[model samples]
Target: MGHCIICGTSVDGVVCRSHQEDVAFRFTGNHPNQLTPGRFYEGTVDGFADFGVFVDIGDSVTGLLHRSELDRRLESLDWDEGDTVYVQVTGVQDNGNVDLSWSIRQSPREFRGEVIDSPEGDRLPDDEPTPTTETEPEPEPEPRTADESRNDEEPEASTNGGSASVEPQSTAGPIDSGPPERVTVDALEESVGERIRIEGRVVDVRQTGGPTIFEVRDETGAAECAAFKEAGVRAYPEVEAGDLIRLTGEVERRHGGIQVETESLKPLAEADAEAVVERLDDALEAEAHPGEVEPLAEDPALADLTDEIADAAGAIRRAVIESRPIVLRHTATADGYVAGAAIERAVLPLVREQHDREDAQYHYFDRQPLEGEDYDMAAATSDVTRMLDNRARHDEKLPLVVLVDTGSTAESRDGIELLDVYDVERLVVDADPGFETSDVADGVVPDDGSITTTVLAANVACGVGDVRGEIAHLPAVSYWEEAPERYAELAREAGYGADAVRELREAVALEAYYQAYEDKRELVADLLFAGDDEVRSLASHVSEQFRAKLDDELETVRPHVETREEGDVAVAVLDTDAFTHRFDFPPTALLLDALFRDLRAEHDRLVVVGLDEADLQIRSTEGIDVRELAERVAERVPEGGVLASGVRRGRLSFLIGEREAVREAASEIAADLAA
Candidate 1:
């Protein structure tokens, strides 16, 4: 038997089957069926066709090089008839028609070895002559001892031409050829500068200008491993995200973060991979849950939702462990901003602890503010498009979408359905009684509007990680009126008094209105969680602007407000388009809320309705089904095309041309219902 050329292993041919693909072949047989698929062969361009080009594998065999198999456009080909080229034989049909594909390596020199394929057998090229019986036979050398033979047969160097330095030896010395003991990523800090082996699943793979970075996660934690081939080239291209791989590398620090310099990375066998997966699943199940914690305040609604809150928190923590990105969507309002920020404050630290990359927090968590109170189709489309792009470009996993202070009402059903189609994990935290529960969400914290969404989110935040103090004041800020006494005391202990919390709420509300679509993470954090001096200074400045804008709007609308008495109910009405800023800060919704609160204080029972050209907003202390009211109005004025939108916030929309008629009918209907 001959020895394999790449490795000194006994084989029937010059190269073993394992390394046969590493070398290219020159087909000498005439029939197409004699060609072997998946092996590269030297060929000549015969001619071009409308669909593809024809390549002659040998003098008698021709194959079609379909345009679909080309890396570039077929018209971009610069080949001339009879020019030598390299192509891979993809398949040979039963009819003996051969199919060829493009090969990046155009010359045989690019391959490790090249041999001729003949009907007799494979053999070396003409330059390397073989010994014949007709010629003189050389004298045989004396047999060497086993030890001497082993010493002489040195391991052949790899000729794959990849730039990765895949030496599996330890830094101190040559380790045993058997698999090394596996180390967890969390323990990598102690093993810096020491070679180690690790087994995990690849969470993400990113190609940089210098190295290919693989974010791998095991039971303990996740870390980045960089494999270098050449500048701007991919290394270990076969390794992909979600692959269960066994990696050998040296732990090192880069830019104050732990990184592994990959020596060798290969996917594990099925049995070994299953074992690793089982281990990871066990650890993840144990660590994904948080310790039992009570709600921040003593409210019946929040107290009743304790288990659901814990489930939401557990999902967020589990996402961090799996290296899945968390996308937070919230309404662009004071309560919404506070609720979203509370969750962000709790999750950022966990992200840092779970990932070794310095930028892991940014990569793993993102917050987005919604323009309207509902998570509508527009918002869902934007989110889906961006996440799909991230998955395609970076090999990132689909993100966990958490909707806060919104997405509870039926208005958000369409958006939630879109996310369900992709099988994305979803969690919703809203205090609106109008919440439409669905089996699609992984977790939901529903309330009867006795508490604000900020309170629910803060409680969930506590269950996620230990950042209770960081977000203690957020629940208080969410309440425009008196916050729960317990939450107020918690905020005081966190160094924020009632006035300070109000200032922060005002600042966030004003900022949230201006850039309604932007998260404004840094600015919001400064307003809520910065040092006392910074928070006081920034919150005071922004609060002053908020008060000025709000007071101006209240003053302008109060003069136009028309008050009328219908039985025991005091009905107040104002033309929003004429009396208030149609497209400015202190939005119509906020203005209506403030006006309704003020009117309620003056009158025993009050209903404030702000009428615009095509929209109407109502606010009342009594529980009213705004959607039912809209349906009644639509029946009375069939030509108005009235529709109930944003039922949780009490909003109605109608055709602009029929606004006057719808307005009159809505006022009469609302009066009768109140009476």
Candidate 2:
């Protein structure tokens, strides 16, 4: 009989049956049959297959954690071979094969207690000291150096140069060896093939097919250190990201970058870790903020948002310094693309300059285009999944999510909250003034009709890096109508004339519709920042296509358009479903924009209504609130079940069965523009 570790109740083993679920067991038996069903067991990842992962519970017994049992997709599992994980033994087959299920409790600290389950009986783990009544008088301990402390905690090297065995701490250091002097990661260039020690925080860890790479960051900079255990195996299962570690290795130039071939790596003691963290904090504080960069063309609206823009820039710079990924999510529109491209131009240069890796730019910065103006749940969920997968698989820090021309309205609150749940740093830059400014974002720059989102992002980008010339024309390109003279002049100063800017805007709009989801970073960069000849050639060709497509769509819709007037407002209504191509180029939003521009030339106060079977789009010169319009329509025609879906795009949803009534009500509301 034994006492339960938690309640001290008498039981057959160390843990009672009622408390078994709360404790994790270390299997000591050699066969699969020894594993008790429904009991959690600590296991090491043996290998992975297409169907599932092979986990070894003990020396001889292996279990299959099938993909179906995983909480996430099989490809999303971040566990490398030899990583210690927890699993529940679901059953043992007739042939002694074991089936395991995923356990929510991953870390041992999450469990109430740990026990050793063997063929003899269950017992406590070896590390759990036995309680004793006798006490011994302790002698005064001598002060130990940081190197000696690390040596005591270092894992014993295996004879085959595979997995390591952790041994109890010893008071004495290695025989006939003195402590190695610590060096910064930046100073490793001069010490190729030389063995040296470095102390830094482990910023990231990635498990490759051949070796485990640890991204170590000291006060000077960050660099990768490769530690080999076995192919497709974790080198040091105990060391993880965010740990302060002391590592001794040989500096070697690998694949055109500096890498450390690790000989010994271990966590630093608390005091040493704190000292290193303090040093890193001070250094990051000193270097993370970029030099002051003024806005290209200042407006009072932008001036009011100066603090927010500075904060956004600071957040981006700090993310780069900390080696965290930067994810820019923007609306899939001309303005949004311009905004995203401006920031991308600024960030890519910084990423290249900051990291030594050849592929660091692609790895650190990402731009994803959202289909709608709002960062809805779908987009946020996708972002969360990708970020979590990166963190789990690569041990990467959660990225800074920058939402440009999206994630500002009340409709995006749910998505913003999801990011908030993960404590992700969010920076929003939108021209929409209806955004929540309280606690939804770490930094936000909301404009009031004076500037476009591209202008805001360009200003923020200037603070991120020195890319003023590269993105000077983006602000002018974002404006659908005539851009402000100041921004147009700024573009001219940057070598882009008014015709060049207009052509680039049209080219981006056309391209943005084709691959509505893709970022098209290279193509956008060429169109915006390529040499004058290339830009003019590409932009002119693409803009020709844009004009042709728009003209074709307009010709088809013009004949079907019906004109109505209530009081002084001219209302042009088009049954978009019947008149326009549903799946072709010039999407409804873009089509409506062209129609509005054409009809606006005829009437002073006009509203263009693109009416579909289930939804309607409105474009007005009167600055009508789409949400309020939807409300009035819903009250007038209750059977339509009308709802305001997208405010920025002036979109409303209604029941298909009541399409005619909804159309009439929407047309009536559109006439209210004259009011």
Candidate 3:
């Protein structure tokens, strides 16, 4: 018996069972079957494919080192044919096809020991020194029976298919070899019932009251591997989510799926861990060339925003690469949802490709629709608090918050400043025309537009160069009625028909109001990019329901509203909080949109003032400088403490805490308009 190299325990093999994955082996066998499933081998580059590189391991084993297996992109590989590299033989199929995985450690010194896997038994390489002992001497030959002599002479023949119980005296384990062969989480299907090695960043770690489960993910896939120290104990207290690690374990079919029983695990250094992420960033960056993108819109303003769009796209790509979470904050409106959905649509696929975990997209990115007109302090506080909690609990990196459709306005300045306190960089892709996003934004897309925020976000998605074509119809969906001729033409060119576009608009608007807070991802994706003609029917049904709800709510509110002429303005007054459902579909904004559309005439300046306990929200057909109006009101009623709260929604709140004061301010403003 030989001693294990890592623990120095006596064993019958080159490495003990406990440290099997810590060792690498070179296959000298003739057939693929003779090569161990979990062992690494030296190989030569045979060829390359779009999916992976073909590697010739030995005389009979040629395996595919899939692009998904590499820590880097296939395009970045600088290897040529006949060039030597190292890979792990993860599996050998029944048809004799071999599957290979990439190794993070390429040099021989990285491994604990190397052994030759011959047909008869494992042995030391010819270049390596044989194991020697000081205390326990080598065994001498002893008398044996004729049958025993024959069996000893032909151990390979005796064990080939026969019942000869000859345990080959392979010298005990070698020194701490490096980590075992790295396999993709997806490749475990072929390796069921076999011991294998895999390397990945720990996506999640949880305890089952029995064993600690680590959800590890390589580029290709993710799986849960369990480690048990004892009953009801935490196996690896130091192991946490987001740690890059290499593990050796047995792949077993558990719960009708493949899971691993981990034998050993090692955390990889951050410097070495950068390889996998750096490769993904390179691929994402290559896709962002200007030549790859065609046109956002015919408008010169949209054209000018291209550079800013590209910058934001690059930042997003880098965040995903570095495994930093991205928090998407958008206004809770149809325009905002459309914009947020477009970015979400673009980012999820890349997240799935770069990281192996199925849930990494959810973990790495967030699509939270902001309430009201501006990303106010309350919203920012909640977002910062939740993000900090996640960072503390999961050891997650500080998230990059992308403000969609809201942060551009001056109203969001205070909220933006609060996020900046954490040193969090914020990017703003706003469709608002009135206010500049300069002071608070790290990256800003500046342009004037009645164009829906989705179109702007879509342009940003395309700026990334990997934008999905399926989102081509989403911009059309963002428009409630008259889509600009240029945008409509572009949408038509992208295959969005008039009916589908309208249906998508109705459906998204309705969905946006219902769960006004949640992103409603799968539902939105299904409604927007159903990939079939029937999606039109699906969107139409939801849109009709949305419109019907709006119609009923509009009629109900009309009785409570009072309309009268006040100087140059046609003022409509309504007690919003008393008449409208506080938490229901058809938001006050949408209802007012319909009211403004119906009441406005070419010569008439129609203003609708909605009042709720000390809050006044005003919407007008003709443009009103609400900030200037608020200044006027603040000057007129200094005791009221009436200040502009949300510029995007024309919202202002009174500090005096009285409903009568809000009505007085609204009345005074309508009358002051005579000036």
Best by TM-score: 2
Q: How much is 339 displaced in model 3, in angstroms? A: 0.6
Residues 1-52, model 1: lDDT tens digits? 6665554456675665545555678889989888877677899999999899
- Residues 1-675, model 3: lDDT tens digits: 886554455778555554444456777777878877656688889999999999887766788988877766678787899987878777889998888877655767666677777787777788777665333443574454453354355332111111112332221221132334556777899998665778667766755323467777676656878775532356667766766666766677654566787655666555656765664335545543333345566666666666677678877776776567889999878788888888888888778876665467878889998767688899999989998998877667788889998888877888889989998878888888754658767654554556767877887787554664667767777887778777777678877778768878888888888767888988888877777677657888998898788888888888888887777767888888889886787777777777767766532677888887777878776566778778887776777887877777777888645557657666667545533
Q: How far does residue 335 in candidate 2 sit from its true spot (Å)?
A: 0.8
Residue 110's C-alpha lDDT in candidate 1? 68
Show where candidate 2 strays beyond 4 Å: 1-182, 187-197, 208-211, 228-233, 248-263
In terms of TM-score, how similar is model 3 to the real structure? 0.62
On lDDT, who's better, 1 or 2?
Answer: 2
Listed per model in order, the count of residue pairs whose N, CA or C atoms clash below 3 Å is 0, 0, 7
- Candidate 3: worst-modelled 10 consecutive residues by lDDT: 156-165
Candidate 1 global lDDT = 0.80
Model 3 whole-model lDDT (C-alpha atoms): 0.71
lDDT of 2 by residue, 61-105 (tens): 999999867756778788999999999887899999898887756
RMSD of 2: 13.3
Off by over 4 Å in 3: 1-9, 12-17, 20-293, 434-437, 601-603, 655-675
Question: Model 2 scores what on Cα lDDT?
Answer: 0.81
lDDT of 3 at 284: 42
